[model samples]
Target: MISYVKGPLVDIFEDTVIIEAGYIGLEIHVPLSVLDRLPGIGMETILYTYFQVREDGMCLYGFLNRQDLRMFKQLISVSGIGPKGALGVLSAMTPDDLRVAIISGDAKAISRAPGIGVKTAQRVILDLKDKIDMADVLPAQFAAAEGPEISAGGVAKEAIEALVALGYSQTEANRAVGKVEVSDDMTSEDVLKASLKHLAFL
Candidate 1:
């Protein structure tokens, strides 16, 4: 398997990039989200790649981060989702947001992706909910601070859910909310607003 590609970014098309490595230009299909984060042309970049082989031919799909690559793998593992469909999902939302959507059973969020219907979104949630872990999806800073308050599903959990609904990554939501000073009198909305203020400076 071709695990990764590292080279100068020679060209970037609508949904693909050409990386020149060892005198060979490798074409890699990437999600729109990856393209948004790519460096300028001629800069060296590394892409975690998945090589797909089928009866017709072969292709390469690349991601900017290992987490995105892992999410792509998980999405494709679903019965009705193919590589293209999985890429569409990644293009629509960050991997962290996708994980939150799955965990929260937010089919509408998943269905926002092109070519993904409500039924498919539900299927994605149903299939991947138990498979994903908040610790695995959240950044180390957030995961290290996880306590009974967040785990036990209270105002913190509700705040995180609201942030996720607003398109923030789970890591971003978690870290931001963790930084906020919570009180017994605070509502989920208060926590969310405080978290947003914290995230704005980050």
Candidate 2:
């Protein structure tokens, strides 16, 4: 039932973060996609968490947003996908992109993850496709927002496609674009450059 952890980010590893909360340090496993979103060490941040337990042990996986947490939960629920496997999927593609790939039967796209093979990707789609709606890929608030919100999403989408054409996975491109602080004046190409700089860090 521990929904989240909030504190200054004390340290960050390749796929984990340490937060100092209430005088104790909490080590949390996080996806690679969350790296760009993390604040500088000593800066406060919050991570939505899922607590997993098994006969062997217990673990905590965290995400920058609840949407990712929800997606992680959905992924782990699929047969043959464990918590680490689900995290790998999200690390490879955004939840929206994964949904699109699954719904479109694009197993090749999903199989790009580190350990997931085509068969596991197919299983994930088979088990979860019926649970997703096409419309769910878009954030609900932006679905009806007519102007700025729509424009931002379009810019990001265009940038993501451009990055994909460059051989970056959907997750990396999406996260890179997200890390860019694009003003209304910035074009998709401009965002693309900013995203490239972030990708260089990765």
Candidate 3:
């Protein structure tokens, strides 16, 4: 198990990042909460990681802090919650707010996440109530109501096209980039990082 990584951040986009360590670039998936906390590209960074192994592929989840990782682990333990689903919940609500809603039985609020339904929301509450601290999860900050725009030229466009080619809807890709606050100066590599975080939002 790869516990963590410490290296230069060669790229930063919305959802994923490429860290260069010992001449190899490691791709790591990230959520918006962690994306928001990252320093700019070409700098050094450290991330705690969770590695998921499957017959078809291998995936890496990167977290900026232990608390987020712990929350993620707790989320995925609930029945019907996969990594993607757990990420969706975290993207929409802070860990504290999620716990409070669960403990308080606010299914409506939990159901507000894009893919979650009323029954699933209630299930999440019932399953996780004992595992999380009601006092620790904070209220999540929804992105401002603005349309995302792909910059007019270069790698940003390529990145968007790549995301679309990879089966993401244009609106979804745009929203992901927007949610991550990706700047115009980045390359496609950076855009991928931004995309990973934005994907979490969806």
Count residue pairs with overlapping backbones in model 2: 0
Weakest 10 consecutive residues of candidate 1 by summed lDDT: 144-153
State in Å the error of residue 37, model 2. Answer: 1.4
Per residue, candidate 1 scores C-alpha lDDT tens digits across 40-79 of 9999999999999999999999998787898899999998
Please report the candidate that would top TM-score against the real structure.
1
Segments of candidate 2 deviating more than 4 angstroms: 133-136, 139-142, 145-202
- Pairwise TM-score winner, candidates 1 and 2: 1
Task: State the displacement of the C-alpha of residue 183, model 3, in Å, after optimal TM-score superposition.
Answer: 53
Q: Which model is ahead, 1 or 2, in terms of lDDT?
A: 1
Model 3 CA deviation exceeding 4 Å by range: 134-202
Best by lDDT: 1
Q: Would you list the rank order by lDDT, best first?
A: 1, 2, 3
lDDT of 2 by residue, 17-134 (tens): 9998898898898887888678899999899999988899888899988877888988899888899998888888877678667755678888998899999988987888777643
Which residue ranges in model 1 land beyond 4 Å of their true spot?
147-202
